[model samples]
Every structure is written in C-alpha cells, then in structure tokens.
Target: MKDTATPRFRFIDHTSDLGVVLYGKNLEELFQNAALTMLTIMLGDIPELTGEPATINISVSGTDLSDLMVCWLGEILFLSEAEGIAPCTIEIKSVSPTLLEAELRTVSVDPSSIIREIKAVTYHEIKVEKRDDHWEAKVVFDV
Candidate 1:
C-alpha cells in the first residue's frame, strides 16, 4: 500500500509555556504525527540518528478521540521519563473512538541532548473530527 501523508504540527510559544498544535487526516495519523513532533522538540534533526530502533507498546482509553490523543501522548511522555527512551516512529495497531493501541520505536538519546522536556499532554484547545472522510485532531504539549 502507498504510504499516507503524515500529519502537520505547528509549534506555539506562550509567555509561560511552549507546545505544538497538530492536524491530521485521521486519528491514527494525528497521534503518530504528534508523537513525532514532540520527539523532534526533544531531539532535533531526528533523521540524523543512526542508533538501533527501540519499541514501545502503548494502550490508552478516553471518552473521545480528542481525549484519547492526549492520553496516548501522555503515555509516551511517561516512557521518556521512566525509561529514558525517545520514540521516533509510531505504528497504530488498533483504534476506536475511545481506545487506542500502538507501538513506538526510537533510539536512546543522551540526557544532555534534550533541550526541552515535555511535562505533560493537555486537553486545552484539543479537537478531533472528520472532514470529507479524513480524520483530524489538534493537541497541545506542555513543555
């Protein structure tokens, strides 16, 4: 199958915090792209890494796709904090309106290489919906 285009994420800087706003054609793509953006902030030019791939298994549930997206990214942050891992690739195994399961893979990074650490994923200004058969969502990361 031809690879689908990935989602687009924009960084936003507030007086007190930094975050990203993301848009995608589907829920899976939205979540995957958000993760990529977050990791990019943590490690710049991720395409330059030649390290071995690492994998992460994630499962999350929420009242809606919007909430689910936040929860999904929250798990990734948890992995970074607890396991010292940074994910570069995400693969969705299954997703529903309220639940999602996926695998994430990335190489390790030096603690000093992280310029900014994301504290959490938030529900603020979050949106997830379908437009002309394409799914889309917006999320903000707490940095």
Candidate 2:
C-alpha cells in the first residue's frame, strides 16, 4: 500500500482527558498505528534512537476487537511508564478479534524526553468496527 494510503490516527480531546483513535484496512495495521499514536502522546514527536534498542512483547485477550485494542495499547503504555522506554516502531506478530501480540521496539527515555505522562487507558467512547475493507477503533488514554 502507498504510505499515504496506509492507516492513520487522530487525537480526541474530552472535557478532562485526551486520547487517540485509529483506522486501518487490517487488524495488524490498526494496532500498529495505535501504537504510534500512543508513542506520539508520550513523546510529542518520536525521537530517532540509533542504538540500544529495547524490545517489548505484549499479549492481550478480550471478547472483541474493541476491547482487544484497548488492552493492546494499555500494555504499551504500561511498559512505557514502568520501563521508562519510548517505542518508535511496532511489529504485529499476530492479531485476531480476541487476541493480539506484538513486538515493540524502543529506546530508553532520557530524563528530559518525557513530554507527557499517561496514567491509564480508558474505555470511554471506545469503539471498533469493520467498515468496507477497513478496521477502525477509538481509544481513550487517561493522562
């Protein structure tokens, strides 16, 4: 697919919270874009890390794709806060309606690299759907 034709993400602001939502033509793409969106929120702009790459492995299960999306992103957020790392790229190993696994590659964050801290992932206004050939999801992050 053309780069411009690939998945995309957008930010959504609520009364007291901010979040990201994403859409793609496939489940893997959707998850990948969501990871990018989450990283953007944490780093504003994803920094180029040329060395000492760290890999994060995540597996999440839910009853549906929407819940799975939340869990998948939540795992990334959890690792970022707990491990003090910022992911710049993601590779989806597998994805199903109820299960997802991925390898997240990132670099350790410098003390000054943190722009915003995300506290949790929320279920508010979360949605996932298959429209035409595309899959879409909206997720909220608690900052």
Best by lDDT: 2
Name the TM-score of candidate 1: 0.80
Error of 2 at 41 (Å): 1.2
lDDT of 1 by residue, 72-132 (tens): 8788777666577777677888889899999877667667777777788878888877777
Per-residue CA lDDT of candidate 2, range 2-49, in tens? 355653887777777886668877889888888777777788877576
What is the lDDT of every predicted structure here?
Answer: 0.72, 0.79
Which candidate number has the best TM-score?
2
